[model samples]
Target: MKKTLLALLFGSSLVLAACGDNASDEASDANNPQDAAESAAGTEIEPEKIVNQKCSSCHGGDLSGGMGPALKNIGSQLSEDEILSVIQNGKGAMPKNIIEGDEAEAVAEWLAEKK
Candidate 1:
């Protein structure tokens, strides 16, 4: 069940990223300031640091699996949007509505490259 959930989440992220990317060209100018700023910051936010500061308590440093599941290959498992959703809404055993807006998005972008 755990692996299944992870797979589902991963697939969702990929689908979401692809969908979002397809629409990016049309929404470039429509992006809010926060989106623009996050885009300016570039992709990937250093998972090690973000994990230590915001997620280690539950997810652990190696992200091999803990209160949360093994996350080492999450980059390959999930897409940017799915990652963002997890950060924003969390998942079973994980709290929701914690990280918000850009922080969530930045972490997502970072995590997407983890694999």
Candidate 2:
């Protein structure tokens, strides 16, 4: 019983770790500059930064593929609008609205250029 409990705890930790996003925590803090910047329009959202921070875990650091499918050439398969839809609505293991509003648009635009 003890061993089973330990195994469950370890598995749970891995799952939680994979889903963790420190940037989201910072963005939620009202006092943080990131929150303010994100709220404003035409803020020059950095899509690459968002991808590295928000997507690298699942899509792989280089986006060659990992737990998620290879997105390096996603534009070859999906248009900018389609990509945005997936980001907004999610597909398969991917969750919806990982980043919302202008930030989501920026990332979708950037990824669409990947092809």
Candidate 3:
């Protein structure tokens, strides 16, 4: 029983460590900003920031999907690059040229593989 409990605790710790890493990654993604000029120059921007600045306006708070489609599981449905392109270029009622350069990339990353 002692060994079994130890193993369980160890496994739980590993899971927690992984979760922490993912959380950190998410936080890092959010804090990082997209350099519009840099993106135009070929550098990509972080995704979370883009969602906060540009997407929250229409996509509902926290990507709940208001004027736009819900993005909970978008990442599973579409590739990161595809989402980035669509946001950058815009489609239909989305209007073109809303998000520029790295901002587009950031928003795409946030939306990609959501859920």
Q: After superposition, how far is residue 73 of candidate 2 from its true place, in Å?
A: 0.5
Specify the highest-lDDT model's number: 2
List TM-scores for all candidates, in order.
Answer: 0.56, 0.73, 0.53
Write the residue-wise lDDT of candidate 1 on 4-70 in tens digits.
Answer: 9999998776445322342554377356766667757776555456556666545667777765687
Q: Candidate 2's residue-wise lDDT over 1-115, tens digit each?
A: 9999999997776556545665667657657777666655355778998888788877889999987898999989999999999999988977687778888899999999999
Worst ten-residue run, lDDT, model 2? Answer: 13-22
The Cα local distance difference test for each model comes to 0.68, 0.83, 0.65
Best by TM-score: 2
Task: Please give the range of 10 consecutive residues that has the lowest summed lDDT in model 1.
Answer: 17-26
What is candidate 3's lDDT per residue for 1-115, written digit by digit as tens? 9999999997776445322343554566566655334434666465676566556656766667876776778898889998877776676556555667656666777777585
Model 1, which residues run further than 4 Å from truth? 1-47
